[model samples]
Every structure is written in structure tokens, then in C-alpha cells.
Target: MELVFVPTPGMGHLLSAVEVSKLIIQRDRRISILILIIKVPMTSSILDSFVESQSRDNPYPTRLTFITLPPLSNCPDPSSFSFFQTLITLQKPLVKQAVTDRISKVGSPALAGFILDMFCTNIMEVADEFMVPSYIFFTSGASLLNFIFLFQKLEDDEGVDTVTKFNDPEIEFDVPGFVNQVNGKVVPVVFLEKEGGSSMIIDHARRFKKSNGIIVNTFTELESVGVEALFDQVSKNIIPAVYPVGPILELESKTRGGSQDESQDKILQWLDDQPSSSVVFLCFGSMGCFDADQVKEIANGLEKSGHRFLWSLRKPPPEGKVGMPTEHETFVDVLPDGFLERTAERGKMIGWAPQVSILSHQAVGGFVSHCGWNSTLESIWFGVPMATWPLYAEQQLNAFELVKELGLAVEIRMDYRRDWKTKKANFTVTAEEIENGVKKLMSLDEETKKKVREMSEKGKKALEEGGSSHMWLGRFIEDVFTNVASN
Candidate 1:
């Protein structure tokens, strides 16, 4: 059987899709994966290199093929129109044509189904037209998916106007399977009275219901309650079958390639010289970075914490360069005066570091993360506790789930926000706050470390033979083929 996996044009989404595809192929040698890459402006070089490396390293390279869709004729600035919105509204036709051509040449039966990124739900129509099943690949955890489904139902039942009017200072909403109320702020900003936010979410929800099933990049052991919620009768009819086959993280060899550049080698050497569990690894996701003021504050915090540190700092993008990759240089200008010299003995600051390798290192005990789901899973997989600093997207929710629900992470600033128009209108996470968070995380209270280690073990075991995730993947494969055969 062959599957066409459609990934959004972002690093996190692309990586998850690729990892899941690899899992599927490994589980069933007869199955092959064809990745449909949607070309977009503001691509990540890291993403490009990762994809190239996957093809090179795969034992059965012939089982995978990557096809890039034609780029948009005149791509608009991503700030004005999000890549998600543009892909849904404008690029659907081009993508449909590409898939249609491939299917026509290969014959519909040769392709088992479509596996789509959550953001690429618009392509499900093509699946329907071809009379084949399509599944949604949620790149985040089960809790976020459950919340999104419940949020949609609330809006539909209560009326969009009524739902949009909720402006409580700290509203608490209940979703099944979670023990506590989800903080209102952690909900997506789009669901809260933004002009197009509600409609977009509702539309995605509607599209999600149409898919045959969902494959989430989280294991059952880590989120049993949230995973169970998706299967509840109340949701079973609306939400499709869910397959929790993950902690499907980037492979270590692929992540830590043999051909390390000079800078990566230096970072590795530094790590090798450090004591086991003595360093804190700090990295924001691809889109995360702090302004000059924030950078200085972080430097101060690291110094005050007095812990060995390895910080990957990126330069903030220029004004109006939203979604553009920002360049990073040495900390000569970005850090505080003499900060580097003062901490030279204990800290190593780099423009970029191999995050997977760093997280996997024994010397690294804790993570200061932006709490993107990919980063969250990576931290969990490596048994690294986190100092959570949520920036945007569902990171706030992930932070809440980590610190509040799961007791797996320490909190930094869950309520930090910035007004893009007014550069100064932002909440600064003070140096003191950063220092406390880092200290608490690095201290590694025995209980938190124990919990993280247990979850880490469970995550790994889930991918092993006869594990929960392994069984789910097998069930998903059988269902896909069975459903098509019945049709």
C-alpha cells in the first residue's frame, strides 16, 4: 500500500509528518510513503536539510518520494495573510491539480489514501473526489485536539456571538478527560473574538470531522485521559477514530548528523567536557526569539542562576519580516556588556545548536523552552524537565498541560504577550523571574525527575512491539485497507 502525506510548509509540521511516515513504513514493509511538499515563501534551511538527509539515510529510499507543488505566482507577505489561511483559501486548486495528476498517472487504487497535516485540511476534498480515504495528522498532543473539538462544539451550541462574548479575566472551561479547567488565555487567540478566528477554527473543525481518522504525534501513556476523551461516545460520532502512535520524534542519527559543521562540533565538544546532568539547554523554536532587551534579561538571569548553560540565541527579524528566517550572530551586541566574559567558564552561547543532540546529551538535565509541541515532546523523550516560556500558537496550552496538568515542567511566563504594532507594548519576563525558573528547573526535584523519567520510558516503549502506540498503528493500517476494500 502507498500513502501520500501532505505536510504544511513549516519545520515542526513537516518533521512530524516525516517521522510518522517513517513509522508507518517501518511497521509495514509493503507500505510506501510519498510526501507532497507544498512550496511556500520563507522556507527553513533546516527543514530542507532534514528532508535531504531522510532520503539519503533511508534503507528503502525507493519507498519514499517527495514532490513539491508549484509555488504561488505572487506570494503575499505572511504577516498580512498567514500561510495556513493562504493555503486553505488560495493554494487549494494548485495542490488539487498536483494530486490529481499524480493519481491519474498512478491509478487511484495504487494509492491507498491521503494523510494530511492538520493545517492542510482543505485537501480532503480531493480525497473525497478520488473516492479514497484521507486521515488527519495532528502534529500536537491529544489534549490540544480534545480542547479544539470541545471548543468548536461550545461555539456551535452556544452560538458564535455568545462564545465570542466571553471576556472573563480568567475563564475556566471544562473538556472531557482533563482533570482541571483549561485556562482561557491558553485557548487560541483566534477563538476569542478575532474577526476571522472563530470561522477559521469552525471550518477546520468541520473539515476534521470529514477525515477517516486522526494520527497524533503523542503516545497513550503520556496523555491517557486526553486520549480517552477522543474515544468517548460524545466525541466518537463527530471526531474520527484516533491513533496515538507517537512520541515519533526525529531519529538521533538523522538529527545529529555525522557531518557536523565547525560550530556544531564546538558545541558538541563543550557538551562533552561538561559534567553529567550539570547543564541547562535553552532554545526557542524556529519562530521564537527575543528582542535585545529580552536577550539582556536572559543573560542576566543565566548569570544569576549560576548554572552551567548552553543557549541558542537567534536575532529577531526586522520589522515587517514576519515568518522570515532571522539571522543570528555572535553575542557581541545582543548580550549585556561583559556578560560573555563573565560567564565564559560556565556558559556556551551559540547562534544555533543541534537541539536533538543537545537534549539527548547526559550533561543536559533541564530545558528552557518555548513549549512548542515538538519541543515539548523532545524534552519529554529525553527526560529533560523544562522551564516553560510559551510564546505563540498553542504553546501556552502546552505549557499549561505540562506545568499544571502533568506536573512535568516549571513555569517561566505563561501570560506573556506582545503588541506587534507598538513595539514597546509587551510584557517582559523579568530577569528575576527567569532566574527563579531556571533554578527551579535545574534543581531537578526528585519527584519531577521521577515523573519525567517514567514518561520518557513509556514514550519509548509505546513504539516498541505490541505497545499501545504500536497496536494503534497496526489497527490504523488494517482499518484503512479494510475501509477501502469494503467500499
Candidate 2:
């Protein structure tokens, strides 16, 4: 049997989905995966290279396949909700036709199900048309999933003015996955808005229930409270079966070929020269970038902190747009003059990073990150403590879980968002603020460090034969087969 995987076109989502597909095929030889690659604008910088590498490395290419769908001609050019909404709509008929061709071929493998990235839930319609079971592979933690379900319940079932209530700091939500009641303020700013990302998320959350299950990229041991909360009396009715089969991280670097390899060698060499546990590594997710003013503050912060560091600084998109940060030929334009020379011995700033490898390095002690779920899991996997500086998506919420709910990470600023139109932060994080966060992170207390180490060990064990995630993966496969047979 084979399963079709539909992942949102973002590099983070696509890579994680690809990793999970490899894991599933490793566990059960009965299954092969066909990843349906949807085209999104401006992702070729990394996406194309990663896909090429996967094709090159897969020993059994037939069992692990990738099918790129034809790009839509008039899909909005931006990488916003509207672009994705239109792309999915126009691509639906193509997706259906692809499925038709696949299962229709003579003596081909059985089409058991589809595993969709969270944002790609609207494509479940194609799964329904094929009479196949589909699962939503939530790339975030179980806590965020709980909140999404709770938000959907309030807006659709109970006639509450959800956005206004979410905005009110006094109105804390009772999310089953959280130990403490939380105001929606800490979540992605989009959730509080009436349209744009908020509408996309709510619409996706509603489609969530129509799927057979949710395969979250988290392990039960790492998120015990949040994973268990879904089965609580109140949530059971609203939530579908959840499989916490993860910490599905890429142990190997998905190197973008060409200069990427040379860059990695230099990065690893620099880390090797540093003293053990002495360097702080700062890398935001693929889309995370800051304006010139914010960039100066960070440079100032790093210089004042008096610690060895590795920073990945990207060129922010032009004002009045939201998009990926491009590589800067030199830091001279953004940095304070003589700043690079002054800090040359103690710090190194590059354009791209090999995060998993860096986290695993002996010289790396702490991560000052954007708190993307994939990055969070990688930090935990390597036992590196983090200081959260959230940029976009449900990152602020992840920051909250790490710092307050689980005590796994320190906070730079729990609530920070960049205004897309102006391409500047809603409010700047002064050099002093950045310095303080770095100090707290570098000199982090032993208690939090111990928790992170323990969790890291748990994350490792979860993919072992008898571990929680392993068992959950097995259960998910069985359920897919059962559901498909019944269908």
C-alpha cells in the first residue's frame, strides 16, 4: 500500500514531512509514500535543492517518490494566506486527477491514505473524492492543536465574538493542552485578526475534524500534558484521534548543494575551534528576518554579551512586503562600521545555517532562536537550551509553552511580531533587551538545563523500538490500513 503526502510548500513544513515519510517507510515495508509537491512562490532557494538531494539519496526510489503538481498561472505571487488559498483551490482538480492516475494504473500499489500538512487540510476534499482516509500531520506541538480546536469550538459552536475575546487580556482561554489558562495574545498575531492568517487557520481547523487522525510531530513523553489533554472529556468530542509520533527531526543535514557544502565545512571548522559549550548559536527559521534597525540592535547585543557566537543574519525583504530573507553579499551595509572587525575573533555571522549539526556540536551551549517547532525539537534533541525570540506563525505560543508551560526554554520576548506591510518589528527589541536575554541564556540556571537534557534523552528514546513515538507510529499505520479496508 502507498500513502500520498501533501505538505504546504514552506521549506520547514516540506522537510519535516519528508523526514516523517522516510521514518514511516523505515518502520513498515508494507507502505510506500508519494509526496505531492505543491508549488509555492519564492521557495526555490532551498526547496528545490532539498528535493534533489532526497531523490539522489533514496536507495529505493520507486517506493519513495515525489510528484510535482503543475503550477497555477494566476496564483497570487505573495507567500501569504491568500496566495496559498488560491493555489490550493486551483490545484484541487489537478490533485484529484493525479490521484486518479495513480490508483488507476494496472497492478500498482494500493492507495491507503493521505497525510497532509496542517495548512493543506483543505485538500482533504480530494481524499474524500478518492474514498481514502486522510490524516493531518500537524507540524507544531499538541498544545497548539488543542488551542486550534478550542478556537474552532468557540467560533463555530458557541456564538462568541472570538476575536474580541481573544484580544481582551482579561479573557483567558481554557485550553486542555495548557496547564495554565492563556490569553490568545501570546499566539500568532494572525489568530486575533479577522482575515488573512486568522481566517486560513480557522478554516483549516474546521477541516481538521474531517480527517481520520492528526499525526503531530511531537512525542508523548516530551509533551505529556498536552498530548493527554486531547482525550479529556471536554476535548474528546471535538478532537479526532491524535498520534504523537514524533521528534521526527532530520539527524542528517539536508545540505543545499554547491556553495552550501563549503559553507557547512567552514561552520563546522569554526565550531571545532571554539571551547566546549562556549558558543551561542542564533538562527531563526527560513522566513525569519529583521529590518536594518533591528539588525543593528542584534549586532550591538551580540558584541556586548561577551560570549563566543554563531549568527545567521539574512537580508530582510523590501519594505511593504512579507517574504524570505535573501543572502547579503557582505554585512558591511547593515552592521555598524568597524563592528565586524571589532567582533571578528569572538563571533561569526553567516547567511545560512546547518542547525541540527550546530546544535549537536560540543562548542554550542545555547540557542537564541525564533521558536519554530522544528527548531524547538532539534534543540531538545541535542540537549541545547534556548532563548525564545518568536517572529511569526504560532511561534509566540511555542515560546510560551517552552518558557512557562514546560520550563524548557528561556524568553527573549514572548510576544514579538513584525508588521508585514512596513517590514519592521511592531516594537524594536533594544540592544539592552537582547543583551539581557543572551546573558540569561548563556548563564542559564542548572535546573532548566537539567530539564532540557532529560527531555532530550526522552526525545531520543521515543523513536526506539519500544518507545512512545514508535508505538504511536505503529498504531497510526494500523489505523490507516483498517480504515482503508473498511472504505
Candidate 3:
């Protein structure tokens, strides 16, 4: 049996898809996997390097095939195109052609089905034409999935304008499958008020229902309520068969690699010099960075907190771009004058740091993150508490879910939004707020630490034999074969 996986172009999405694909391959050596790479703007090199490394490490490299699609012609400005729009509108035809060509091959492997990222739902039409099953591989937690279904439910039942009118100082409203009222603020901003945003979400939900099932990158123990809620919603024909087959994380060995680069080694050595559980690891996601002013404020806050820190500082993006390559030389110039000199003894700032290795280190106790789901999982996997600083996309929602719903993170700024188009700043987190958030996360009470540790253990156990996540994955594979045979 062979499965084709299509993941959107973001690092987090690609990483999740890679981990899940590896899991699928490990389960059955006979089953081959093909990854159809969609070429998008921004950085292709990062995705290229990661894919190359994964292929090198796999024992059955021949079984894993990665095909990169030709770049889109006359591509729209990335700043104007929402990532979803770019994938669904621009690349759908190319994806269809690629899959069609692969299936038409004379001696090709039997194409069992397609596993698509939630954002890649547009490919389902091709799946139908080929008469193969399609499944969704959501990269985020179950809670967020549940919220997305609820968003569509509200739109269908109460009209689109009902959801579009949501504003700050969030009003609580009941959502099906959830025990408590979900705040409007906790919903992804795309669903709130952006033009075509709600429509895109609703369309994805509609297409998701057409898929065979969904595989989320979270474990039942970590999100049992949300998992149950998802199933309930599915039972009501809100979506599809839901499978919780994860906490599928990239292994530490892969992250550490065979040899470290010079900078990585230096960062590790600096971490070695710190006391156990004393340093905070601060990194926003790959796309996360702050302007010069925000950088200076963060420095002040870190200084005021008086904690040992490792900061991964990236240069701000170009005028219109959401994220850009970090220039190491500019980091010092952008920072406050003498800030580095004053904190030189206790703080280490680098252009980029090995996040997974640093999180796993004994010296790290807390994470100051952008609250991307991948980062959230990594922090939880390492049993490090968080100081949530959400930047864009569904991060704000993830931050709220972590701090308020899950009680796992300290909030730095929950309601913050930076306009991507106009580059107008909606809000800036002050040094004091950053300081308080760091102090709160680092000084977590015994109860909170114990709770996080327990969750961490539960995540580990879920991957073991007979565990919920393990069993769900097994069932998913069996179902795929069963469906194929029946068809």
C-alpha cells in the first residue's frame, strides 16, 4: 500500500506531516509513502534541508519519495494572499496534475489514499476522481479543532454575520462538544472579521466533512475533553471520523543530528554552564520576530527579571513581509545601547539556537514562545512551562487555550494583533509585562509543575503499546486497508 501526503509550506506544518509520515512507515514497512512538496514563496531551503536529512536517516529511503511541484507562474504577492488562499487557489491545479500523473504510471506502487493537511482540503476533488480515500492531518491540538467545527456550526446555524461581529472583551458563548463557554477572543482572528476569512474556514470545514477521517498531532490524555468533543461533533455529521494518533514528535536524535554546527555547539556549551532548571529558553516560531522597539523592551524585561536566559533573536521582517531572514550583525545594532554589555554575564543571545536541544537540556525550566502548536507541544513534551507571547495566525487562540483553559502557561499578551498588511502595530507588550510573565512562569508553584509533569508522562505513555494514541493510529491504518479492499 502507498499513501501520498500533502502538507502546506510552513515549517510547523511540514514538520508535523514528516513526523506522522515516519510513524506510518514505522508501523508497516511494506507501506510506502510519497510526499508531494508544494513550492511556496519565503524559504524553500529550510524545507529542502529537512527533507534531505529525513531521507538520509530513513532505512528504507527507496520507499519514501518526495516530489516537488513546479512553482506557480505569476504568483501573487505573498503579503496579500493568506496562506490558505495561496495553497487552495494557486496550487490546487498543479497538485491535481501531479497526483494524476503519478497514478497513471505503468509500474507505480498501488496508490492507497491521500493524507492531507487541513489547509490542503482543495485536493479532495482529485482524490474523488482517482477513487481513493482522503484524510486530514491536523497539525494542532484537538481543542483548536473543536473550536473550528464550532465556528462553522455557528456560521451555518446563525448566519456568517453573527460570527463576523465578534469583538474584544470577548463575550462567552456555548459551543457544542465543549464543557465551558468559549470566548470570542480565543477564536482565530481569521474567523473573526477578515474579508473571506470566515468563508475560507467554512469551506474547509465543508470539505473536511467529505474526507474519510482526521488525524490530529495530539494525544487523548493531553486533550481528552477536546478529543471526546471532536468525536461527538463528528457523530453529529459536523466533520468526519476523528483519530487522535499523536504526540508524534520528531525524535531528539534527529534534532541533535550526527554533528553540531559551530554555533549550535557554542549554545550547548553555554547551556552546560548554567545551573539546572535555571535558564529560560525564548524563541518565537520560525516566522516570529519583533521590530527594534519590541526587541529593546524584551531585553529590558529579561534584564529586570534577572534570570539566566538564552534568547534566539531574529531580525525584523522587511517592510511588507511577515517574516524575513535574521541578520546577526543587525541584532546588536537593533538592541538597546549597552544592553548586551550589562547582561553579558547572565544572558546569551544568538542569531538562531537549536530549540529542541535547548528545551531538552536540564538547565532550561521555562519557554517564552509564540505559542504555535508545535512549540506548545515541544514545551509540554520537555515538561517546561511557558510564557505565552502569541504573534499571528492561530497562536493567540493557542495562547488562550494554554493559559486560561489548560493552566499550563503564563500569558504575556493574549489580545495582541499586528496588522500584516498595513504594518500598523495594534499593541506592544511592555517590558513590565514581559518581566511579570517570565517571573510567573519560572516561579511556577509546586502544584502547577506537578500537573505539567504528569501530563508529560501521559504524553509519553500514549505512544506505548495499547495506549490511546497508539491504538488510534493502528485503527487508522487498518481502516485505510479495509476501505480500499471494500472499494
Candidate 4:
């Protein structure tokens, strides 16, 4: 059977979709996968990197295909915009129709089903027209799905002021099905904004409500209540199916089994030499960037914390673009005095680290992360506690859930939101906050550590035989191939 997978343009989203596609192919060699990447000439490097990464001693079947669409109206214009903007803006009519036409022309009666990223909801119309079963794949955490549903309900009922309640510290809304009260400001900017952003999200949410099934990058055990809550809240007519098939890191590891790449080797080597549970790994998600001051503050904070850490300090890409930073060398040179030498015996800093391998390392005990949903889930899967420093997008919400709700993380406060003026006026976090957060996470007491270890063990087991994630993936394949495919 042949299947088409459509992913949004961001690296995180692309990686999630790619890993899922790889897992599907791994389970069934007879199934062919085609990945439709929204073509952007200037940003092809990002796409190329993903392709190259997939080539290093991986078992993903050779039948994977990448089809690029021509620049068309209604397609996101990628000429000069940030990654997220490019993704949401690409709602061109011509491109949408072209994508529809291309899927229809797949030429095989054996075309079974489609797996589509949530942002590409525009594809659902085509799915309906073609009468093919399609699954809505959420590339984010279940909390995000919950937030989307809540935002939509609020907008429909209460109007603009209700949305603004998100930023009010005193106002907390009881999220249905879950006991936690959420701060309004933590909602993603996309859903709250008034301009082009809101429309895109609304469009996607509408499509999501229409899709035949829902697949998320999460395990059922991790958010069983939230998932069940979401299903309950959606309209009964369109609540097709929900599956939490994840801890996608395991799939990545399985796909990259026996990899011998130099980058991977270097990470292993670094971990091998470190004392067990003595190293901290720091990384922000793909799009997270700190301005020059924030970066220096981080370096100083890490130094002051006096911890043995490995930081993946990726430079900010050319101001607005997602490619390599133009002054990469100069950027490295601006580190605080003796930043390298002072931590010479204790820490290692690199541009990019093999994040999965590093996270899975025995020596690595805690992660200081931007709390992207994927990163958060990976930390849970590996049983590592976190020093949460959510920087952008849904990261704050992810951090809140992990730290406040799950007791798996320590929150580090910083002005992470986009309002520069507000950030300037109220950003109270400093090097001290970073130091304290790291110290707290790294110094989990024996009892706390034991609890963390227990959760981690449970998490790992879920990816193994008969675990929730494993069983869910099995059921998903059966449903998609047998039920959806037969239809």
C-alpha cells in the first residue's frame, strides 16, 4: 500500500513526521511512503540536512519519496520570512489545489491512507474529495491540543477579552478533564493573535475536527486523561479516533541503529568519559534563539552554577532566516571571559549535539531545555529530570505542565514571550535564576530521584513490548492498513 505524509515546514515538525514515517516503513516493507515537502528554494538546506541525516546507517526503507511543489498562490511564500511565518503563510489557493491534484494523480488504486501534520489541515478537503482515509497527526504535546480546543471554545463564546485573560496572572481557567489551572499567557501566540495568525490556526482546527483519525506524538500513558478529555469535548459527529503512539525517540534510535557517524561517535565519546549522572545537557528546540545578551547570560549562569554540563549552543541563524549564522565564528568569540577555560575540566560546548544520543547517555542526569513538546517527551522517555527554560511558542505551556503538573521538572523564569517592551519591563530572571534552576534539578534528593527513576522506568517500558505506546502503534497500523486501507 502507498501512503502520503504531509508535514509543516519547521525542523521540529519535519523531524517528527519523518520519524513517524520511518517507523511505519520499518513495520511494513510493502508499504511505500511519499513525503510532500513545501518547497522553498532558499531554505532547501534545512530539507537537505534532514535527508542527509536519514542517510547515516539508518534502516528507513529506500522507497521514501520527497516531492516538492512549485511556488504557487496560496502556498506559503518562503522568499523572506522566519520558519514559523513561512509555514502558516503558505495557505495559497494554487498550491493547495496543486497538492490536491498531485495526491489524486498518485496512480495507484492501492493508495491506502494519509498521515498529515495538524498544520496542513488544508489537505483534509482533498482527503474528503478523494474519499481516502486520512489521519490528523499532532506534532506537539496533548496539552497543546487541549489548549487549541479551549481557545476555540472561548473565542466562539466570550470573544476577544476572554482570549486576553490568558495573560492575567490571577485568572486561571480549569482545563476540562484535567485538574490543572492554566495561565492565559501560556497559550501559543498563533491562536491568540488577531491578524493572519488566528485565521490559519482556526482553519487547521476546523480541519482537525473533520479528519478521520487523530495521531499524536505522545504516549497514552503520559496523557491518558488529557487525550480522553479532548475526545470527549470534540463534536460527536467528527470525533473519529485518537491514538497516542509515541516516545518517537525510540523509533529514531531503532531507525538509526548501529550508526557510526562522526557526530554520533563524538557524543558517545563525551558521555563515556564523564562520571555517571554528573553531566547536564542543555539545548533549546530548533527555533529557540537567545539574543546576544541572553546568550552571554546563559554562559555566565552555567559557569556560575559550577556544574559539569554539555551545552548545545546553536548560534542564531542570520537575523531573520533559518540558515547558518553569517558571523558564526565571531558569535562564538563573544563568550564571557574564561568561559571555556574556567569550565575546561568540567564542561563541553558544541554547536550541535546528537540530542537523542546525548539524552540517552548514562552520564547525563538532567536537561536544561526550551521545553518544546518533543524535547519534553524525550526527557520523560529517558527518565531525565529537567531545568525548564521555555523560550518561545508552546514551550512555556510545556514547561508549566512538566514542572507544575507532572513534578518532572524545575521551572526557570525568564521573559520568554515576544513582547519586547514587556520583556524589558518585567523580565526578572537573571543568571541567578538559571543557576538556581539547574542546581535544583541536578540536586534532586534521593527520594525525588527515586520517584523520577520510577517514572522513567515506566516510560521506557511503555515503548517496549505490550506497553501503551507499543500497543497503540500496533492498533494504529492495523486500523490504518486494515480498516482505513480496506475502505
- Estimate the Cα RMSD of every predicted model relative to the unseen true structure: 2.4, 1.7, 2.2, 4.1
lDDT of 4 by residue, 128-229 (tens): 665778788898867788777666666665664443556565566787545688766566655555555565566567667677678888776677668778
Q: Per-residue lDDT of 1-487 in model 1, one digit per residue for the tens? A: 6788888888889888887887788878878888877766667466667777777777667777777777778776565625457655566677678767766874442778889888888888777777789899999899888877776777787665534554553878777768898777666555664555667777787788888889888888999888888878336487788889998787553443554566677888999999999999888877677778888899999999999999988766676555533534644487888998999999998876678888888999899998989999988988999988887777878888898889999999776654332233237888999999999999877988999999999998998998999999999998888877976
Candidate with best lDDT: 2
**C-alpha positional error of residue 485 in candidate 1 after TM-score superposition, expressed in Å:** 0.5
Clashes of each: 0, 0, 0, 9
Ranking by TM-score: 2, 3, 1, 4
* Residue-by-residue lDDT tens digits, candidate 3, 303-353: 999999999887666776555546343366788889889999999988766
TM-score each candidate: 0.94, 0.96, 0.94, 0.85
Evaluate model 1: give its lDDT: 0.79
TM-score of 3: 0.94
Q: Which stretches of candidate 2 lie over 4 Å from their true place?
A: 77-81, 169-171, 233-235, 328-331, 420-422
Ranking by lDDT: 2, 3, 1, 4
Candidate 4 Cα errors over 4 Å, as ranges: 26-30, 52-63, 70-109, 157-162, 234-238, 250-267, 318-330, 418-428, 481-487
Candidate whose TM-score is highest: 2
lDDT of 2 at 106: 95
**Lowest lDDT 10-residue stretch of candidate 2:** 323-332
The per-model lDDT (C-alpha) reads 0.79, 0.84, 0.80, 0.69
